[model samples]
Target: MGAEGGLRERKKLQTRAALADAALRLALEKGPDNVTVEEIAEAADVSVRTFFNYFPHKEHAILGRNPEHLERALDRMRTAPAEESPLTTMWFVVQDVLRDLESDGQLSRRGELIMSSPTLLYQLMMSSFDDERQLTAALAIRMGEPAGSVRTALIVSAAGAACRVAMDLHKNAPDRPVVELVREGFQLLAHGIDPAFDQRGIS
Candidate 1:
């Protein structure tokens, strides 16, 4: 892209991020239901019309439309070695994503804000469901199986569960490295989630 085009793209990304940050902050301070798109746009120093150019609605702004981690995970799935299982590939991908989230403190704050509001929480859940569906389809294509097949669905959902469990555990134990917790979760899945599975022996 040309210099002028690149500058415009950067400006757009900056504005979008500013809007999302404002939405999360305001929601945290005044409850999600109480927050309005006009308030959010004002917080970000943008007009209401400009906000619509970036996001369809307030919920979308709060969630943020970009799913960088999902995109990266899909790319890893595509390039993973032929012998690697889908679960194994996702184990690393989840940890990598979690580490990134941890580095960006704002993400933890976003999670807190989302959890505080039922509306935001439900929207986030639906968004995650859609992400899982996309990943399931990608895995199916890679394995030459039907996207809706039970086997593919189980694999994707199980992996997603492990990641969620790890995040929950980390939330309860703030002193622990989330990536380490994520590995333990994946280790359980690797061993059939067996009661007798030795998690420490996996790595």
Candidate 2:
């Protein structure tokens, strides 16, 4: 039963990813306002009912990050070494997330789609805020600080900036290694963005 359940869950994830990929590609190809849930379902070779099963609406599918990926990131953040600083932990998390997204080869396309639509961009930002809140709470527990503390927000903001820069760099230079760019961004953040600092590596 457990094995069967695991298989079922994997199938659900695959279907959700297919719907999202279809919605994103269609949105980019034919503007977000031009896309329809029926068309998205057809593109994914699923019924409109199946599309609704995974996403509440067309916009959600276009702007959605995979739930499996988000859960994996949160789990990694929670299980990261206690001795590591929050920034260091987040650096590793960002690297892992980027690597996983790269394996599927959709991160750049998703970014482009989001940027092209104001509504989608707003939805994505709202989703990100929820994620940030959860991440901040997790880190605050580790540091024995309030989740609302300025120090906690600052750390999260720095890590988030590095992530955004890494993603933007990847979108511009698809051939370059994202992990390397991420390392450089984080190293700069860790060292107060000193242009003169040795950035041979991040430690």
Q: Pick the candidate with the highest TM-score.
A: 2
lDDT of 1 by residue, 134-184 (tens): 888888888889757888778888877775565566566767665677677
Clashes of each: 0, 0
How would you encode candidate 2's per-residue C-alpha lDDT over 14-54 as one tens digit per residue? 89878888887888889999999999999999999999888
Taken over the whole model, the C-alpha lDDT of each candidate is: 0.77, 0.78
Q: Give the TM-score of candidate 2.
A: 0.82
Residue 189 local lDDT, model 2: 80
Q: Candidate 1: what lDDT?
A: 0.77
Q: What is the total number of backbone clashes in candidate 2?
A: 0
Lowest summed lDDT across 10 adjacent residues in model 2 is found at 64-73
Off by over 4 Å in 1: 65-69, 96-100, 166-172, 176-180, 195-203
